[model samples]
Target: MDSEKLIHKITEKKALKDSKELLDYVSESGENTKEYIRYKTLWAMLQTGNEMDEETINDGYKAVKRNVKGRKSSLYINVVKYAAIVVFALLGGYFIHFADFNNEIAMNEIFVPKGNRTSVVLPDGSKVWLSNGTKLVYPESFVGDFRNVQLEGEGFFEVTHDKDHPFIVNVGKHRIKVLGTKFAVVAYPDDEQVKAELVSGKIQFDIHLGGTGDNYKSLMVSPMHSLVYDKTSGKVYDSTIPDGFYDYWQNGVYSFKDERFDSLATKIARIYNVEIVFGDEELKTRTFTGTLSVDDNIYTLMEAFKIASGKPFEYTFESGKIYINK
Candidate 1:
């Protein structure tokens, strides 16, 4: 039997008459075919909720075993071995079903361009404010035990409250797990630091040092707290943020407290849709603590920098690029 027909039969809960043929196909199938079977079976089980009792599970095992009882071929032995996994996948969806497992789950990707900010209401009624130059990937409908999403750049999330299903955000090398909370995440691939600032409720921040599950450290983030991870040094530190600092950017104003110019330039470039070229290295070291409205033009924003620098600073804008010198 072909994989499609086999999957249809399984999904339809039809009694197995061609068990031997199915076993033969599974035995000769490659890894991808096996994975497809597992994914389809799990998806079907989720939809139908065909909970199998202990007796049924045991009966399935016994039936498969009896089919291969007198067969001495190594291929039959392999089939018997693989049948156990297939049985479990059909009976109970207990295996590792990652966010990428369900091929049928529709994915929606939203990109907020360099000069614009946008907001999206997820299917679960969660609201997300995507900052400029942000890429957010989420499913049309969340399945399984977690609401998983991927974010590049920055975003503010107000996740819907679901105690049973935690909301997880994958940002760079870190994963932020939350349960109906409002938080902000900054994790640009080009940046040296990744930060997760919690506005309310609690979250768990996990830093995967080497992209391996075993080499990771977890931090319990509380309300009004910011967890910063240095990508270069593999160091993590937690500090307190102001009451409204996290969500301030949503209103077209950015507030920074003693933020370095070099670090701030990335955000400024993204918000203003301009490339900032610093001719003087010293300008990168300057730190400023203030608020700037994103609605202002590039010259106005550069004038603010000049006043903050307390020195003669000049800039030239040409073809969407700003060259700054002091």
Candidate 2:
């Protein structure tokens, strides 16, 4: 096939009867013929409203080269480049013809570092507030019959209502199923317990344990209720918690009711992005019941704890660590 006729066929998106022969001619052609074919083909595609990125063309070239191995002569190189353009242009046309190709599922991951919190609005309009050191994996768009996401650390979700498409969160060994509900999930990988606190609506929590006869168990949780699953004991417990207690951290408030200092220290360390070392063993058993604003500096927050404890407390910060002594 002549260069002019080949370019015309490519631009018109018509099947070439002698595609191999045309490829051979382009590969054996002189520098002038090769350049003319390359530029003319590009201009024709542009005129036909076909735009392609360099990366996509390069990827297509690599894909074709991987299937056919040998020394890459100038002829082979030119043929590869031409093949890449053809493949990419055909793919662009295919995407244009099938609208659903735009909706192909893609996974997106978000990480929130220590001392910082972040919020994301999902493709379905559901909002998620991620706590410090949290990792969330979600789809770019919902497909199939349900919407699902995976969570690590902690997150507060205000899911949009879609009764037909229930939203599911997979945290550790537990799965939370909900249909338009506000809830908070605390399932840090380092923690021994996973807790799901419902702010409104209802959620079903499923625990999966392999090998046992009653390996799978489901618990329905209502508003104002918190479901706690102990990984060590393999037990699930439900308790009534103060409304919004789970989500207070979203607003920089750390609320605790008779929380041990040991556990509180962990929260403080995560929120302040520091390590807490207790110099006095007795401080670990000390219980605290109050709300502390995380917006304050670490030293100020520690001072509030000292005042609440009514004990002589002192702390030193060094090397990104806080040494608490009494």
Candidate 3:
């Protein structure tokens, strides 16, 4: 009889009258037919909740024994293997653990560039939102006396308070220490400065910078205050700022009061990932003071700048790059 006819006959029988006859039929059957019988036999055993005798088990497995040994089995063997795995899992004798997880230290740094934003949790349980063009370097595992992290560019931190493990941020030569505080730091290397603007909670700064003898000169930041650091001059300027300044990163609209054109363009370049070229030296020196919405596209922002300054400007976009002309 053909394999299909044989399978139909096997399914029609409840139990074979003779074990030897069944084994002989399985041995003569094709791999597919043997697999089908194996599945039906296993399912029958499970439904009855009765363990088969050694002879009956051995006869049923013999049909698919070669496939199982070679890891070439069909649905029957797969079902059996998965059932065994589940049994082992429930027994708690074996479980997948950290040894299977990644243990290697992450080597590369993670950066969130302009016009893009990202959120990540640190090893110290602190949550950070990385702004565009921001670079954060942290170890895969934080090991040491204190939980410390390094940052370049800009980011907003919503730190998890842990009295035992104080959080420290290393930005350039300065160190910002806090037990728990909500703060934002804008420290771009090419920008020639770093600004730590605090929204709430107390923060202390240890300025490695000289000429700042007193703590008042070195550290003077409170709620709604910004500590501006000039890398070239080694000076710190603490100024009172309104609460809206903190919302600029989230809202994508910045309100500048007497902000210089050079400074504003640097921010624009980073946020839009574009280059602003102005041949007019006078225009370059002109300071812009107003509320500008960074949520707008490059063209829209350029229009806003033109309206604010009345300077005719033009721009074009390339592969992941933008160029401006006047």
Candidate 4:
């Protein structure tokens, strides 16, 4: 089968015949090569859908194993190997993480350009999910009392536990410190608000008023709570995480609820890698509430937003840019 057909089978999430055809193709492609490995991972993910639980994963593996038990063939071996890869990749979705080893303390930076999101396993084995248009900087390895890292955009972190070696994330004038935890930080330099959401564990949030770091306010953020700091007014707003919001954006979902169209446009611009110009300033004030898949057409998304606002929205694409009018 061709690449398009194979992707169709995986995405359609349909019958087993499509999966068997893909399996046959992979087995014939030869030993655990890159191509075979890729297919195997996809096949496993497809079998269980995009999301899976512990029980679902277990049952899916056993069922797959049963299909090839009597054969004792190489296909069975390939399936087993694929199963292992899926268990790991699907834990956070399919992504490739590689660490560059350098003996020197030279700083390395990973910049996820507009229109793409990426995940990295840091030197300490902590994983970070970077949203589009984000930059992360750190040393090649950790060799100090603190694992210091800098962030210029939004990122979700799952920090590895280390009591002696504390992990600190520096976001401009503000900083977040943790021993180990899962949390998200949104500190885009241009944005007026810097937001932090703690999913689990405790984190210390510090806001510095000066370069000396002497005059700073600190607070502890508990699990399942979130805080947003307004950079202009220097006011902090605390609230519970809103419903239908999650780090799921790492997996291709651009979800929002009752958000302004202009803000939505900015997010779409980042992911679509496009510049947007609005002919009517009033359009920016409109609000939209919906979930968008990164795979959906940008124009279609715009139309949906207009429909939600009940406004006359029109757009034209030219010179690789989007011009919107009402």
lDDT of 1 at 248: 66
Off by over 4 Å in 1: 1-102, 243-247
Native-vs-model 2 lDDT? Answer: 0.71
Q: Give the runs in model 2 whose Cα sits over 4 Å from its true position.
A: 1-103, 211-215, 243-250
Candidate 2, clashing residue pairs? none
Write candidate 3's Cα lDDT for 46-121 as tens digits: 3322222345444445544544444354544544433443242233222111111123222124455565555555
* lDDT per residue as tens, model 1, 174-290: 799999999999898888888999988889998897855657688998788899999999888889987448446456777888888887888789888889899999988888888
Clash totals in order: 0, 0, 2, 0
Q: In order, what lDDT does every prediction score?
A: 0.70, 0.71, 0.59, 0.69
Candidate 2: deviation at residue 241, Å? 2.5
lDDT of 4: 0.69
Higher-scoring candidate on lDDT, 1 or 2: 2
Write down the lDDT that model 3 would get. 0.59
Q: Best lDDT goes to which candidate?
A: 2
Task: For residues 225-265, write the lDDT of model 4, one tens digit per residue.
Answer: 89888999989988887654563544677667778878988
Error of 3 at 161 (Å): 1.0
TM-score list, all predictions: 0.67, 0.65, 0.61, 0.67
lDDT of 4 at 150: 91
Cα lDDT tens digits for candidate 2, 1-326: 65445554444443222355544544454553344334333433343223345688779888888876667765556556666755764553321111111223334565666776656566677888776788887754678899999999998899999999999999865689999999889999999899998989989988888675546688899788899999999888889977447547445787788989999988988788899999989988899898766576888888888888957888898999989998
